[model samples]
Target chain A: MVVNMINRVREQRPLIHHITNAVVMNFTANGLLAFGGSPIMANAKQEVADVTRLSQGLLLNIGTLHEDQVEAMILAGKAANEIGIPLVLDPVGAPATRYRSDACQRILQEVKPTVIKGNAGELAHLVNQDVETKGVDSTGEADHEAIVRLVAEKYQTGVVCTGEKDVGCMEDEVFVNETGHPYLAQITGSGCLLGSLLTASLTVEGNPEDHLMATLSHYGRAAEEAAAHPDVEGPGTFIPRFIDALAMEVET
Target chain B: MVVNMINRVREQRPLIHHITNAVVMNFTANGLLAFGGSPIMANAKQEVADVTRLSQGLLLNIGTLHEDQVEAMILAGKAANEIGIPLVLDPVGAPATRYRSDACQRILQEVKPTVIKGNAGELAHLVNQDVETKGVDSTGEADHEAIVRLVAEKYQTGVVCTGEKDVGCMEDEVFVNETGHPYLAQITGSGCLLGSLLTASLTVEGNPEDHLMATLSHYGRAAEEAAAHPDVEGPGTFIPRFIDALAMEVET
Candidate 1:
């Protein structure tokens, strides 16, 4: 399954537009590149629509929410939607502030993304539920199936709750993907890269549910492979090996 | 060496203050987390100085330069310099515009950086040379030897030029650390991670030259290891494994 999508990406080399925060901008770009996808990191409102329209998929992450970036996400997301491109929304730190919650809600209402990727805690807050979130990081494990279900139903979109065990839920069906390592949580943009991976997978599968499943499985399997190597001791070394594994795994 | 740094970070988790661009901010933070360093992504002018004082290392990235962020970088970089904390600069998109080059020069003048990280093109521009930089990304190889001595001599700061081959250079000494797959270039924040790695390494090493050599060598070697793995296929898979490799390479 991973090989199939990897073949598609290598053959098609889709362009992904990201209107994300400044924090993970470089990592997100590199993640897409490792996945055999072209990345365009554009945030200015003037260029968002143009860049999004030209790309194959759109990823909107509100990690560092600001008035200008929020507007750009909306404009670019709308353009991507109208052009039949896949849209992935990463509502980062949504529950931390009213401003964030409102901005995320507005984007949800306006963009109507095909997939919404967030930590279980972030998902709970996005749907107006209570959650114990520390700063922007999730406090619970990735195996919380109930929270994933609630978020999927509330948003009417695919919900991916990533942690110790990642779950991808769409309405009634849920896929429990247990592929990643514990080291993933130690890093910041692990979730953001998952978003980029989902976008890359969607470029091939074109099904939000299947795309999410394949990505989580692919990421987890790669993490498992890395963990098997005693030399892969921590996150620093794990990062480069993870990319190397990605390049090979995609090709089957 | 990479494993030692990873163990050190885990043993003594340091808070890294970053006044970076909105882009790549999430990836930087995540890279820090993967390495066991806490990242604080704040760029507000009012609080930047206060925030820098508490950080073990300060990262200044001008990927998406703005007037307000420029001011904050100066304020934070100066404070970091005065407090004897290690300061690293990622001159993102320098020479793209007059505003960027001017701002970079200003920051360099106001605060003496412990180390500077960027591509060959960016480093060339930072030192006021004509390198034909394609936007923020480098078109040349990481070890373009042409400008290494020039950059080191002009800046009076250690420089890590990353690409297919990573080069760490100081005023009199230069080290060519080659490790990393070609696929790394496809990803965006791979360079940003090196910047964060430099910060994490500085928190422990204290010497700018040592930090640059350790970071470039460890990152380079890990990339080599990551590329040797069979299951690692693309960027998606490469990420986790790469982090694992860095964790193992940086010892406590």
Candidate 2:
């Protein structure tokens, strides 16, 4: 099933529209391309609606929040909704500052994302639970299943709470994926890139639940493979290898 | 001299305040860290001045310019000027949009950057010279030395116009560095990363001319080394190796 979903992405060549943060634009774009999806990053409010309308999926990441980009995300998200294409939200750094938190809340209330993905802290904060977040990384542990259920029910969307083990929940069903590596935490944008992969995965025709699980598993396994490279001494070397691994045709 | 300058960056551990676009923030930050400089990326207008005041150097990149970030860059640039720390301006995509051109002009006029870095197209646009630019890349080649001299003299700032050969000029003298690889162009943020390296290099005590040359040389040599790695099949694999090479303590 995972292999079919992965092959679907490579066959369809879906164009994913991303209104993501500046910190991970290049990385996310490269990752999307490596995973066999086309990426178009357009964030100006003047053009986001048009851009989102042309894409198969929309990804809204608030990693580096700015007032204008927040507005642009809303515009693009609504456009994607109107077109009935999948939209993914990555509430990056939601617990780091009020500005980010408020922006994520606003986007959530307005667009109603198809899938909402983040680390434990961001997902917990979205559901009004207390969790410690440093910058964009979650520093506190939460009951991933409970938090995912709360968010999935509240937002009426699929929820992916990622950490050492990734949990994907939709309605009452939960899927746990334990395929990634700790080295992913040391690199910036690992979480952000996962959001991009989720956006691409949703464009494929399949069970939304299975699609989300496949994305999490595929991405995590890729990181594990990259980390096992003999030359990957640290996070710096692991990054490119991860990209190459993402591009590989994995036999599931 | 290059080795001494590089050692200075490792010793001083300058905290570089970056008000750069979002497209390359992670790569730029990682590159700064790899080159032995501390990086702080803050662009919110509310706190840019305070952040700039606390740093050893400033980098203003207009790669992903938005209205609010342009204001924040001006704020941070002025604050850096007040403290008399070295400031580097990367006029990314200056020739691509009028808004970017105006923003670059405003920052150049007000901040008086210690070092101005851009490709031939950007420098030509800054000087009102006709040069073809495809996005951020210079599509046409002109007399790079003359353009660098014109920009350096007009702005009363050192200028580095990068291309196949990087030309650095301070008033009447021009230095050319032919040290980079063409593979560098295939990757995103390579030019933006160079601006980060230049900012870190400028914080070290040295002749401004030699500092610019040393930065270009160090970065180019790193790219060359990364490209030569047996595992580096293309730009995808080259990225991580490049980061690792940058982290290596080269004896210059």
Best by lDDT: 2
Cα lDDT for residue B82, candidate 1: 92
lDDT for every model? 0.76, 0.85
Backbone clashes, candidate 2: 1
Question: Residues A77-195, candidate 1, lDDT per residue (tens digit)?
Answer: 89988998888999886775566778899898889787888888888887667777655676754336887787777777777887767777875778888777886767667787778
Error of 2 at A43 (Å): 4.0
The stretch of ten residues in a row with the least summed lDDT in candidate 2 chain A is: A132-141
- State the TM-score of the second chain for every model: 0.89, 0.98
Show where candidate 1 strays beyond 4 Å.
Answer: A1-6, A97-99, A141-143, A205-207, A227-234, A249-252, B1-17, B21-31, B42-65, B70-252
lDDT of 2 by residue, B1-252 (tens): 888888889887787888887667898877777787877676667557766776889999998888888888888899999999999999998989878888888877778799899999999888899897788889897999889888887898999999999999975678999998988999999999899899888888768788888889989999998899898899888887888777778585
